[model samples]
Target: MDFVEQERMAHGIPSQGKITITVDEYSSNPTQAFTHYNINQSRFQPPHVHMVDPIPYDTPKPAGHTRFVCVSDTHSRTDGIQMPYGDILLHTGDFTELGLPTEVKKFNDWLGTLPYEYKIVIAGNHELTFDKDFIAELVKQDYYRFPSVSKLKPEDFDNVQSLLTNCIYVQDSEVTVKGFQIYGTPWCTIESIPSRCITALYDNCSAQDRKKLRRVVNTAQRITQTNLPSIDSVYTSRCLRQAANIIEDPSHPGHSLFSPLPSGRKSLCLKARTTTLKDSFYPAVIRLLNGPCIH
Candidate 1:
């Protein structure tokens, strides 16, 4: 039915269009996309987890199979919170804490009363008015010190991703409905600055990767400056607590460890944290799409 088709990542080139997998064909087949997606970052192998014991949410669908309802940081709160049944919802963004176009039209009218046939949204780091270069560097700072970003006034957050229009809004794009090949990006990677840093809401970054996400958001406001490297000792709530999730091993079939993460990796290696999280994260709006290794 021609649900949706988008692939916009200009200046960095990433579009084999719809049935995509471009990153120079995932770097000329990186180990067949790392053994077809059981990609582990060897600290000496070891990866094959199969521990799934938790189910129930009106469970009743194994027929045509295809249920994905993953949500994340529902900032504007989804009101009552009772949305289980799924056939693809996957909204991995901050439904708006400030990307406000009346909160993206009330999150596109609550994603049009969700009966998900396909939603697939993305863009996090608190969607700050869709990062028009971080609202042009927070309107050159000092407006009574960002008071919730200068009590806003540019048409109360223009466009705001065209008010969602009821779904599919990926950035750095790539989407396909039923046959699924969904790729999304809110660009972030500073495992000590290899490059890239666009906290989504579009700007195809290149002010030298927005100055390495403002020097890792100003080195988490200093720590008596000491041995710092390996990506600024990772901050931003330890990059969302070293976010990692790779599942799909329902009693292990020909198991690629239940594949799902195969979207041309380029950055995000993060691995440094002992204790940190008292409001810091935007450590370039950390987002780590999972598919962590297992067998």
Candidate 2:
């Protein structure tokens, strides 16, 4: 296949048309039963060239199409708001205010009642209980200095998973539906200030927390390389530094960005968010356009 054909296939474009050919087999004896031959390619003419027009930058999605409704940072207020109808319902993270079992159960119960055909859920920084290692590290780091809340035991992870029966729970994982690939992660970059005050969702000032964050980022990169060659989109909780690194890296495959929900409980659509991702050597700022949003 030529490079153009490969690119076309990558973008799910169809060929202009196809041609059929026939073949005849020769035998030693004229009276012998004729052998059948099947030819899959045409030999007479050149292949047709199909050209797909590029979509305009400002084109609005058509109405009544396959819509994906996205809501995030609900903070355990699932029953208080009205949800739009969509083919897929995606809850980015922070469904629970305190990452407690009761909070998780309430979110799950509300998720089960949604009318969307597909539902995807991911954890947020508040969902510390969902990630055991994260919670353990926080405890070791004297997490009590910040605030005291219901701490989840190790076994509670299984119980939380069981409660989220109606939705697909994704933590550094991918799923496919109707040939569209969607990747989800619950990581967000940690912002640290002097005096050990860490913000930006997940805290990673501790060595163990850093290692776990790296593992999640590495897993995302590996999945992108192995399973996302033909992925249509990605759904992540927040744009962690690791995710931003993957997006800004030119060596990686191209991907679309989906903006994070606004800080409050406003029904805002996805828009591009710009951020600076710094490493040991290079520091760069890039703009990522939020992924597709249909509503």
Candidate 3:
């Protein structure tokens, strides 16, 4: 028996090397959950076929079926949450409330205790320590601003990543397991900008500020493009907050409602926040993927 694995984006562009598996016959009943197959490999083949010592095959067989249990936005509270049994555990991000190293470590410890065979995690806006550039920009604007609680420095990046050792961390990347392709990103739209400056920015800001603003906008556009590919599903930290009026009446507001941030001067910090949420806003991200967008 031969098993070939080919990874491709939704549009048919191959993204990874093809994995060919040759195995003996094995049977398992399929369940209502994701599909799973059992392969009893009688021989181990190297990247190139060669006569080598037979390798031990201790790999555990699937637990009857492939099941996925997903949760998101835990915000560092995991004790009371009851997790269901599944072959794969998916956490969509916001594992930490403040992105603090301590918080991250705590979440990681909790994740390590889960019974799932495969675990996947992604960062959320609250996980600021993961994105050094964004945090540095925020610090420059104002150390006292929102999401600056831990005073995280660029040096903490590796430390944070190291703490989450038990699960696969994904950021604007894709992973394949059991022939299923899963893509995850922590990006989300920042709080909405006030309607007042939506049109005034080009007229009043200084050249430097304008340049900064443009860069922010451009970065957001690029991030949005990352989601344009077709995929089985998307896992993201940011989720669309249903329009309030739409939910209330279904006719009062014809379009989605994005609440604006409290009125304030447009500062670099504000720009950074705006940039994160601007192009890749929840609605826009969902529209581009054309699939179920999990938060």
Residues 28-108 of candidate 3 have per-residue lDDT tens digits of 211101111212134433233435343233334343346567788999899977777667888998898768778889999
- Lowest lDDT 10-residue stretch of candidate 1: 193-202
- lDDT-superior candidate, 2 or 3: 3
After superposing candidate 1, which stretches have Cα over 4 Å from the reference?
1-46, 49-68, 71-84, 87-90, 94-103, 110-112, 115-126, 130-136, 140-189, 192-194, 197-214, 217-295
Of the candidates numbered 1 and 3, which has the greater lDDT value? 1
Between candidates 2 and 3, name the one with more favorable TM-score.
3
Query: Highest lDDT: which candidate?
Result: 1
Task: Report the error of model 1 at residue 139, Å.
Answer: 3.8
Question: Local error of candidate 2 at 19, Å?
Answer: 23
How does each model score on TM-score? 0.27, 0.44, 0.48
Per-candidate Cα lDDT values, in order, are 0.56, 0.53, 0.55
**Highest TM-score, which number?**
3
lDDT of 2 by residue, 112-144 (tens): 888878998888777877777666666556566
Q: For residues 181-269, write the lDDT of model 1, one tens digit per residue.
A: 88887654233223122122113345675567566645632532432333323333234333322123344432332233355452232
lDDT of 1 at 256: 35
| lDDT score, candidate 3, position 24 | 28
